[model samples]
Target: MNPAEQAPSYRGASEHYLSPSRRDPVKVLSEEPVTRRVLTEALAALALPDDRPVDVLDIGSGTADGFSLLTRAADGDPAVVEEARLHYVGLDVDPEMVETAGEQVRSPSASFVHGDVRSGIPGGAFDLYLSCGVPYSHLTRDELVGALRSVLTAVAGRGRRAAVVVDVLGRYSVEWQPNWHLDRWDYAMSFFAGGGSGISEPMTFYDAPALTSVLDEAMAGTGATVVSRTAVDRSVLVGRHTATGTFNPGVPRFRTLVNDLLRDPASVDPADLRFTPATGGAPRDVLDWLAGFAARWNAALQPYTGAGPLDRDAAARLAHALLGLERAGGPGLGVGHSFTTTLVVDPA
Candidate 1:
């Protein structure tokens, strides 16, 4: 099988889903909320047809995770998107993934198909194109551009408004501080037990500028004009790899500490949450941003240090404060673990 066609090894997929890391407070409180916010904004920007259900195409869908995500984004709010009005098609290159998705997502409005976006997008034009899990990061830069160009061209041919959410690995995540100097490198799913298929693949990483360039090139002459682009950085400090320390050993186990704080504030020592970024390699601005964020993060923890186990209320408040700090840090410049860009496209 082509390396590109290889499905992410899910030998322990069930274990992974049931793992604490999957349901950690950071994932539920920060990552999912940010993603859902962007997805909601994208849906709101679209001009839906009253005559038919809104068509959605999920590229690189894995076991219909994107489908679940979209459902949550709608949150049964008819004003945003009604569950009954959604017609979802999930496309992937792995037949096993498609079959698994079909088995998992038994929605009347949802279907899964095997297809690779780099070669072509199956089904047809859609009102929204969605992807998650940084699937596009599996593609080379040129391949991603080609895949996106095909999507834009299809939207243009349809002559309708649409939205595309592109998710990719951020270049400057502290989890891989050592590789900030390189855009592409072997990234392993070390978080999984037994090293997740025990295979490392060369994955692409992107900053806002690089990703914007790819989108611009893909849109050029495709008769698709971007109405707006919103970039969001998810998991700036609490990325999964922070606990594994696989790529950057110097990084603190922020994910584990945060999860501990969420579960039982007394279990974590606030002093251990201090973030001291690895120096050199990354851009100065990125380093500075991390430094600034670290200062705030540490300060937030200072009140709890030596203060003994926090009461339930205090612990909840502190967690909320940290999440707020991440949100107020300004537009994402690829500082997070996952960088997502949602483009509202006008195929006029």
Candidate 2:
């Protein structure tokens, strides 16, 4: 099958959903500080040369919010902030998106282009090839492999070490349990009605092994090699979105319920913990509900982590475990709402 055939074309309806003015929930959720941390960490992994300004190609760079986020991350570091000069090229398939992004993202080093990667990635010799907002998840495995090879080949031609970050949907997410087997699903964000324009787009999901397989195939002949792969954005809170009637009939009013629990765990009485088949209510206990979700995700992750089902106390254990660490995104707590497997590739 043609790779482009498998990808979702976000026109008209979808275009409105990506508008920065609308405060798109998915856009807001994906661009959360925690989520943006993944990109910042990937930037740090580049170990870029100080001798020259870094050239970056951001694929599917919607609204170019990520460019702004990256700049903020660099600015936070006094040591490298002034030392690092960046030239960013934001590429998106949507002409409107490119135009909109061009307006929002302004920098002496940043430029915007309207193009599709299936055809070709514009510019060349970029020190960093970045893809966020699960852009690769729109392509089929074959399409993804082909696209990777194209960019890697271009970077290889330059004969310089570079890093590529591909962010996609996670397979075992509670948001789409009913459609997990199929690689593609219509992701609904009805809550962002203003942004969505009453339309959803088909998106593909991936596991680590599948991602690794494609990356390996893409780099086979090229000088690029995978240095490391890190999983980030293990969101324990996103499954609550399931209650919004956008996903399967599982958790009704999950966000409201989770908010109650977050505010006062004791306020949720024991009676509330019972699942109601008649109403399709989530588990009465918030932790138990989250644990069940975690267990299901763990089962899907078994092939990659070789770990058994996570327990009801998993979140608490993870929280306690995290206190000892000085950082986040070390390894997902196995409860991410959407996981990003950032493969650090070196095109030396």
Candidate 3:
């Protein structure tokens, strides 16, 4: 799919953020603890000069929220925020987003660019390169590699060690398990409430292995070498784009529980369900219900464990179970809604 066609939705969303009441849900969930954590991880990987302003480039930077998060996270540390100045440059395909970001992210050292990062990254070498909000999910596998290669070459040219953070949609996320078998799926709706141009765009999903392979291939001939990688986030709840028609409207109790869980993951009480819909369990107990459903789900997916693709039905079932449970221990690579990988790139 052409990236330009999908610009309307993002353009509309950028305008929505300008409104006091409206906020992008994906950014809200990711910009805080999630982005901050990854930012810290990525920054810690780089060997940056403390006496100079840290040059940072945010690819697919929508509203420059990640930049803001970085500044806020380092507010207490005078070294990162003050002594080493943060010169942030953000790039986005949507001109409106670029414009809005330029206005909202007003800083002496911040700049916004309207361009496609896959073709070429703007500016000189940056100390940090961030691609959050699952921007890479929109690219084809080949395009992703080419884009990464371009970025790596640019960074390599400067002969500077940099930190690059890549964020993508997880294949094992509960939000889109129904379509996990496909390498790509059409996602509809805006990520914000009362946002989105009511359009669907093709998006790719990835597990840690698949993503790591892409990065390795992209950097094979470049000066950038990934030193470390860590996946984080476990968004067990429904995402804004998937919530519109994710569940059957005929089942109100199940739908209500799912909605509640999405609204606040920690505030939900699974015991409040008035009825047991699909997964057989007592209506008053959530863990029992999750365990039973998980057994069935894992059983269905057992054949695909460390093997081939999961059965669509089985994937959907596992996703449902995970959503109902709202938490789990295991791999964050393929399971998180916004699974992030922070790589400390060593300059060639």
Candidate 4:
């Protein structure tokens, strides 16, 4: 898929919902201060030889936490605010996100871009690139290579050093399967206008190996070095990223749902594919609900976005049946099986 062209719609809602829902929610719950401390300490431990000011590029930098991290530590941080006037460039796929972040953040040398970080880095070399969430994990190998090429080109030309703090998906993270459709559904209904299927659909993802391998390759191409890295629980993954840990997919039955989702893109409607929370909805067991949603959505959406040869029409028909408010349980899981991957990305 053309990352640039197919980037808008999906990324739009993704940035909005994940920014607040997943990233903003569990800071305290997951002890963000501790994670921030780890970052500061990591920087401090860096063998950066020169006293030259470091220019930092935050890939998937949602809401500009990189700036905040430079100020004071988060919930459990022990690192003193070794503040530096970093030439910060924050990038996100969502144009609205970059706009909102630019308005709220203030820095003499800071800038925000409404461009694809996966398109590679912006002009000018950077010293470090940070990503709290596994944003790189979302890109394909080609885009990954492009992004790395951009980063390396910038720094190498300037004779500067660069490092990337990436979030790595451990083999066991909840909701880490080739099932991104559920997320698309939730993102659309909750953020986008109601929600409807369209031209080209996105591939369902949970590309752990691809993420790690691509990043390793990206870094390898760059003469930049890796100083220190660590990964804690999602209690630390703040702002728009899902909470780290195991979650439950509430649907009792799910195999059929998974198949249908893997088969069609326009099969189900966003509204029908949801889980109610405790205050009366179906369920909010993050893992369970998210997994179930993904399974059903993947089965239905994959046809259109075929990860392989998933029949387009058949998948759409199945999704349609599932999303038919009459077919789905109105506000429940109806009768489909669900899927989930524990959110366990070891950024170590």
> Which candidate number has the best TM-score?
1
Clash count in backbone of candidate 2: 7
Give per-residue CA lDDT, model 4, range 1-83, as digits (tens): 64556674544443543344333212322324434544555455544555656666778776676666655554454323344
What TM-scores do the predictions have? 0.90, 0.70, 0.72, 0.52
Candidate 4 stretches with Cα past 4 Å from truth are 10-25, 29-31, 47-52, 75-84, 168-171, 175-212, 219-348
Counting clashing residue pairs in each candidate, in order, gives 0, 7, 0, 54
- Note each model's CA RMSD in angstroms: 2.7, 8.8, 10.1, 15.4
Full candidate order by TM-score, most accurate first: 1, 3, 2, 4
lDDT of 3 at 9: 51
Candidate 1 local lDDT, residue 55: 86
1-348 per-residue lDDT for model 1 (tens digits): 654455455444444543554666777777776777777788878856565688899998877777777775432443345567888999987776778789878889899888888878875769989998898998999999999999999988897899999999999998888788899999987776422344478899999889989999999989888999888888888888998899989888888877777678777777788777656677677778777888888889888778877877777777877877765533668888899999999885
Query: Could you tell me how far off, in angstroms, the CA of residue 271 lies in candidate 2 after the best superposition?
Result: 9.3
lDDT scores in order: 0.80, 0.58, 0.62, 0.44
What is the full ranking by lDDT, best candidate first? Answer: 1, 3, 2, 4
Candidate 2's TM-score reads 0.70
User: What is the Å distance of residue 244 in model 1 from its true position?
Assistant: 0.6
Candidate 3 local Cα displacement, residue 122, angstroms: 1.2
Model 3, range 1-348, lDDT digits (tens) per residue? Answer: 655544545646764555543433333332344556667667766755567778888889888776766776442542334413788889888888888898887778788988887658886878888887788888888888888888888777788888877778876544554555566777664444445454468887787677878888989888667677676644533344344434223322333344444454443344332232233211223234334445643454344355434344544443345443433322445555666777777777
